[model samples]
Target: MSQRYPHPSEPAPEPDSALLGVLAAVIVALIGGVVYGVVGGTFHVEISWAAVALGFFTGYVSGKAGGANPVLQAAAAVFSIGGVYLGELVIAALITSQDLNIALTEVFLSHSGLVGETWDLLFRDKFTVLFFALGAAGAVAGVRKGGAR
Candidate 1:
């Protein structure tokens, strides 16, 4: 059952599907990040724009593959952010030099010779996770109700 005169905003399917695609992109990014972190270590260049691109592309592709409604297809561009986080870890692991760079700040945390805990926060993986989550939210929201034209 398809609509012959589909509105620019309306797809043959529904909006929920679009939302789901966004969610899947985030999940994929998380998994990719985990894999890369476990194998490659945590040194990564920040290509946030790439993540956004991936999020949109993956979401769009996935939605199309699933035969999602057109409305959902638009969401695909937003949902693809999932690939960003996941790709980040995997990319980091694959590209890192496998050296001490990963925890440079942390390694020197204690030997500050009475220095402040500047390095302590540097070693945390918490930021990566948080960023990934943000990416997911941004990508998903961007697709579903993004202010994009």
Candidate 2:
């Protein structure tokens, strides 16, 4: 069988923008964080594996929107960490809301100090640290696998 290739006269596709990749990563991280939070809060259980999935989705979206680059990979890693942190914070807020019989937004926004303290306590766990590292690794792997070369 003969191999087919692009014509010599055809122009190469334009490279994706770094800004777009960053934006996509940020958006994915925020959404994934909320989802992680809702699942943990509703079930009153902490599923650490969700962190890895969140990181993978964030990196995959960023990589698909932007070409493979060192800066994008680094950004994906950082965003993954941020996503995990946000998830923890959200979980704290949700639990507080349930305990205090308050709205979730009120607990999250009005009781920032309490939420911060709870988040800190939760974040100090050894398993949380291990999962965080795993999340970062998943993000980098996703970027490498999904990005355009």
Pick the TM-score winner: 2
Q: In order, what lDDT does every prediction score?
A: 0.44, 0.82
CA RMSD of each candidate after superposition:
9.9, 4.7
Worst 10 residues of 1 by lDDT: 114-123
Q: Once superposed on the true structure, which residue ranges of model 1 sit more than 4 Å away at CA?
A: 1-44, 67-82, 95-126, 141-149
> How displaced is residue 14 in candidate 2, in Å?
5.5
What tens-digit string does per-residue lDDT give for candidate 2 at 25-136?
A: 8999899989988888787666778989988888888888887866778898899888887888888888878888999888867898888887777666888887788778
Candidate 2: residue 124 Cα off by (Å): 1.9
Residue 106, model 2: lDDT of 87
Across 1-149, the per-residue lDDT of candidate 1 in tens digits comes to 97678779774543344455546545654554454334433344544444554444454444533334445444443334444444543444333323324442443353332112321333226755555555555444444443222
